[model samples]
Target: MSTLKILFVLYPGVTHLDFTGPHQVLSRAPGSETIVASLGGQDIEAEGLTFTNLADLSKVDRCDVICIPGGFGTTAAMLDEAFMAQVRRLGADAKYVTSVCTGSLILAAAGFLKGKRAACHWAWRSLLEPFGAIVGEERVVRDGNTITGGGVTAGIDFGFVMLEELAGRDYAEAVQLGLEYAPDPPFHSGRPELARPEILAQVKARMASATDSRSEAALEASRRTEPA
Candidate 1:
């Protein structure tokens, strides 16, 4: 069986869980090969954690799947033309183009998600409008070859679905079994609609600055990529 080559785009300020959660599952697939690619192949610091040995973007010629992760740094990436050029190069040929959380915003900025129904972290869902995407509420949204997950934690769920699509249900189930993938969160307030007023206010306040930056960057990217 041919190995499934998966390229994960890692950048500074990444939310580590967004990359690692899905990575843990996808890497374990029977014939999967995972490559984490970053600008200049340098070591990256992700939300206070360091990741080493990331491949340089130029080193990759092609990949079956391209996964992008999200974090505060996504705002900067959206504004980077050189970075988005590499993203467009890789995503143009990938069989499946996927993202976790605000990563969708990056994909949209790269022009890979125009007019697609995609999901993103709820706090930034409005940003998708500039990309012409139909925002979805589901944890994972798949529109043709583009698949996007909602928020950082949704990567795990997104991985399982991607595995099932690539390797079949039985294979994905076995991976789930091995990982003992089951959720029983003590808190019942994960989403804005579910969280108490005070809790939601605190979370929103914390993210306000980052969200504003992302909005500005996403809008600019949308304008740049619009059909003339």
Candidate 2:
């Protein structure tokens, strides 16, 4: 069988779990090859963690699947012409185009998500609107070949969904079983709607600064770029 090449695009300040969660599952797919890359094949500082030995984004020609992860750096990434250029290049012909968490904002900035249903981290989901994306509240939203996941933790669910689409239910199920992919969160506060009022307010306040900055960036990116 031909290999399914999967590219996980990375940048500085990325939320590690956004990429790694999906990477853990998708890398195990049969006949699939995973390529991790940064803009310059340089080391990446993801939150407090560091990732090295990444492929140069510009050097990578193509892939069957292209995955972008979200982080505090989404605003910077949105404005990066070179980074978005590579993203557009690889995504233009990829069999699947995907993103995690706020990564959807970057994709939306690329003009790929205009009028397409996509999910972003709830805290920043509204930011997708300025880019003309149909914001979805679900953990994962698949519109045509473009799939987007909500928040950081949703990448795991997104991965299995992508796997099922690429391989089949049986294959995805087997992989899930092998990974012991069962969730039983200790708290029922994963979402704003579900969290205590005080808790949600505090969390929202914490992200207020980033959200405001990203909202402006998203509007700017939307105006400057056209849908590809």
Candidate 3:
């Protein structure tokens, strides 16, 4: 069987877990080759670590899958025509288009999610309507060849699902076992509805600035890409 080429779109300030969680699964899947690319070949910093030696966009011609991870920089990326153009170019012919968290916003900005049912971080789920997507509440939502995951931790589940699609359920389950993917969170407060009211308020308060910026950027992107 031919190897599957998986392209990961990287940028500054991307959340580490959003990228790494899925990567850990996809990289281990049989006959899969993972490639990381950015606008330039320079190093991009995430919340904690720096990703370096990334392939330049100009050099990556095509791939079987395209995965975009979300983070604080996703807002800035929505405003970057060059980056979005590259995304459009790369995603135009990919077999599967995928994203985690706010990365779906980037895909929507690039005009990829129009009329699709997709998922994103709960905090920003409603923002996708302007991009013509039916927002999904599930941790992992797949419509046609497009798959989107709901927040950072959802990437792992998204990854396993992708693996199953690529290989098989058995293969994916084996990989999950190898990774010891069982999760038992100490607190049942992962999402707003499940969290305490006070905790939800505090979380929203802390994310106010980022939410405002992402909202503004999404509006601008929608306007610029509107039917003309």
**Number of colliding residue pairs in each model:** 0, 0, 0
Worst 10 residues of 1 by lDDT: 207-216
Can you list the residue pairs that collide in candidate 3? Answer: none
Error of 1 at 24 (Å): 0.1
Model 3 TM-score on a 0 to 1 scale: 0.98
Q: How many residue-pair clashes does candidate 1 contain?
A: 0
Pairwise TM-score winner, candidates 1 and 3? 3
- What's the lDDT for all of these models? 0.91, 0.92, 0.92
Residue 162 alpha-carbon offset, candidate 2, angstroms: 0.7
Query: Which lDDT value does model 3 have at 59?
Result: 81
Give candidate 3's root-mean-square deviation (CA, Å): 0.9
For model 1, the local distance difference test gives 0.91
Please report the TM-score between candidate 1 and the true structure.
0.97
Model 1 CA lDDT for position 153: 92
